[model samples]
Target chain A: MAAPILVFGHKNPDNDAISAAVGYAYLKNELAKRAGSDAVYEACRLGGLPPETEWILGENGIEAPRLIESLSEGQQVILVDHNETLQSADGLDAAEIVEIVDHHRLGGLVTAQPLRFNAKPVGSTAAIVAREFEIEGVELPRGIAALLLGAMLTDTVIMKSPTTTDFDRDIIARTAAAVGVDPVEYGMSIFKCRSNPAELPVDKLVNADAKEFELSNGNKVYIGQYETVDLQAVLGREAEIREAIKGLVADKGYQFVLFFATDILAEGSQFICEGDTDFVNRAFDIDCTGKSVWMPGVLSRKKQVAAPILAL
Target chain B: MAAPILVFGHKNPDNDAISAAVGYAYLKNELAKRAGSDAVYEACRLGGLPPETEWILGENGIEAPRLIESLSEGQQVILVDHNETLQSADGLDAAEIVEIVDHHRLGGLVTAQPLRFNAKPVGSTAAIVAREFEIEGVELPRGIAALLLGAMLTDTVIMKSPTTTDFDRDIIARTAAAVGVDPVEYGMSIFKCRSNPAELPVDKLVNADAKEFELSNGNKVYIGQYETVDLQAVLGREAEIREAIKGLVADKGYQFVLFFATDILAEGSQFICEGDTDFVNRAFDIDCTGKSVWMPGVLSRKKQVAAPILAL
Candidate 1:
């Protein structure tokens, strides 16, 4: 048999990033088996698992995906959840991307060989992965259904994120039904299982779900989001958070570092920025240079937050 | 209602290019109408229609897509068959691409907003479009079904091209059955409908379906293909074709210009080159410096010819 193809999500993996990889890998394996091809897909991640993802995997008696920092040159891989090089594995430029299943904006990635790319402007990558299962006519295992349902809820902030569309809602409803769980109740439980933001080290909270983006001026900016039920727990450490991010900006020479804490219950977020704040300030029409600004109804980092800043 | 979104294919339109755009735009319009959205999708072609495409549309009493050369800034658009900017319409950088349905390699297209992108490494974009109609549960009108089947056959060289996969064969079969025609018979009729290659003007023969590509050295190259049952007619015009493309290399500063004539019956192509031939010699291990080289089993330009050249 040939070597197994690696299937992974972006670095700094969140629930959707890691869960989508695992689900998509299983789907591909089934497809390969039915076709009688000697191909295997192994799911991997590039970072630590979030508390909610870890909880779901443990509850379902499923092992976490293997952790990998970089890829070998010419290794065949499939990227899920994200496709941009800046947000992918460390050695992505040297690796061969055979397929991609993402739900983010295109990021100027070029490839030489023709491959399968499936993306939709939906709320979660898990929703896309789940829908593919139906299209491929593969039966969804119960444990996998639960895991995917959990990521779908968290990624969409319990269906309240602005990125949620009719497609997301339909898939979420079908998957949640298959898992025998109420969508809202299950979502609340997952958010509650997250590690307490107030007790975490400032660095961990800021980098939990962050991504690197390039501005139009060719400068790199960092945007992070930490979603919790209590926003005050995160805001209480604003000074320390700012100091931690400022250190990153200085050490990494980043154009800026913006961290936002989203309160799932309140459906809003608080933004704290370090380094040059002009982009965020002008994009959102708010000055958060010295103080944190509370943005009402800002739930999704991809759609509501980073998208506007990147547009600037 | 907002402005109608324009849908188009590559600049040098082929049968698959223009036909796929027409099929996809029709599918999008149906979806919008089902959802009660006032989104209108207008199918447009970037270049003159292929003779086969014109025959199919005329046979079905369907109108040809509008011809467009450039796009206005901020105009919403959808791309089909091809995704590379170098192969797309002029002013593509300024237009907003809201969706893409293609079967080619990624080409460094960046967008500020997330959009729907569906690509597969199957034989033809028409196959993908036909599958979408099934997925959306929209009834395939007989005219459109016949139109799509024609493209699927021509693009895959009647299922003889190496790029043809199980997916393409399955969709082609289903669509042909729906249209009440034998697949091979219909395909031959479409190929026979194509205009005689020998009688074409020299420039039109050379630039009929050519596309510009950038090499690793950051230099541009142009590649064109002419497929026919008669290869002798094209081979007889080698002198005239060489003279025409050499003029292009001198006027446009291209690194090289490669043109091939594929005999569908023989399943081979004759490659002719002008300007720098190092790239071609190294890619295929053939010397066509001043003489034509016959490459056996080279039917699809994208899969058999361009892919190897670009990989280098």
Candidate 2:
């Protein structure tokens, strides 16, 4: 086998990110097989595997690509679903970085790959992987098709993400038809699953993945994002979450706190806060209505929303 | 060969719902294949398809299920991902529904074929599918692995949903690894993908597949859900979404509207409204500060938030 192709995802691979890496490796292997090229593809993760990741691996019947902290020496590597800046992928010497497929905003340092680089801010790395299948003219196997769909669903929030493109929709439509899945109900089911909130712990609900940034004034502020089908419904958890956050802030010694109640249906956000509301307002450059600040038509926090506010 | 077992999903089949139906069908076929039975499995849809569903099907190399407006007599059907509830499953019938597998709350109609029913609130139907693979001693093919992962990721909102169980987590870890996916990255990626706000239409963001009911006070109210990873960042889209809802309410002539801006990280909802602010206050039994309300520790509208408030 022409030196095993080390197909791997970024440091922390998500569902679409990891699946795309493996799926593309699978696709590339098929292509090489058709071309009579002797190449082997191995999927690997570079970081600690989470419980959810382990569950996915076991269910899929594939062994975890033995976790290696970094690329092995002499290994030909293909990076999927992340840019260099987000996580350092600079360990590879020039030729080792063969192919790069990703969906985040293109950053510097990743422009030097020699083989192939597919990057789009569309939705998921799976969309990029699906595109590769089309380019190779290979009929997707059932496994590959399902992987692609998973990638798109996760990345696009079932098409609720603004990164979703017409091309993405077209790809999804053709793919769904091929895989015998119904698009409308699939989207609705995802919404319904997200609609129920009673079973969640208050802290896990509040601190699920809150991000904190250090300010120039030596102040640290944290922002948390929650995506639910219904904001009004989550109102039920408000008291518990508020109490938890209040305790957490006191415990963590944070300067300010912000929470975003995002309405994908309304294409807006309601910013909720505690502590220096004025400082929070100045940081975000918005007027709070005491309880929440209304932001209309702001779905993309990375590009359309966060970048602008951060610039301010 | 025996006629292909026609399997259909609940109306508006979500990823977990559709993936469970197809994945289970494949497992049954594998069982039959090993058992020397000539049974084949086919997956079908009950309604118009969603965007991501197509992607899942395409990636899996399967075709989209045929729509079931009015099932003809003698059609063999297996219901997946939803119960026989007009509240959710709408028109999926029992006479044809030979097998019922789902993860939603129990609905009005009990499964006639309770022997084949696999119902549990394990968040995603994919979890149930994974369990089925375990129960039947069927090894999931790579494609099937992808389907299960897709279902789990979407249904659990990348593992942020309250319905996610240890079983769900375990299956997700295993299935992801089997497909050479990284569990941590996959979960985080799904959340990130869902966080993109620009890819979503304001209307779909606010009201896509939203549910409504009449209160005891003769007030009819509608609640829409939108989940994303970056609620604060997407707050910029609030104005457009509010306007869109206003337009939708005007067009639909809805009496009252409520939208939930669920902060997955903060574990609360920033409530927004256009019609009948009093209705929102009455529904949540709280005071409103602006066009928006900050409700903490809230996740689900149906079980945790709405049902309780509506009761009062």
Distance from true location, Cα of A64 in model 2, Å: 51
Which residues of candidate 1, in runs, are more than 4 Å off?
A: none
Clashes of 2: 114
**Cα lDDT, all candidates:** 0.93, 0.63
After aligning candidate 2 to the native by TM-score, how far in Å is the CA of A291 from where it should be? 75
Best by DockQ: 1
What clash pairs does model 1 have?
Answer: none
Write one digit per residue (lDDT tens) for candidate 2, span B138-177: 8888877876797787666666666667777888888998
Q: What is the TM-score of each candidate against the true structure?
A: 0.99, 0.43
For residues A1-312, what per-residue lDDT tens digits would candidate 2 score against the true structure? 367877777654555656777788888889879868788887776655433344445544645665666555556777777544335344554335656676643333322111344555566778778876875588887656755675676557678777777768988888878767776565444445442556766655555434454444556666665655687765666666666666756877766576666666776766767655566577567775346666776554444443443333
Best by TM-score: 1
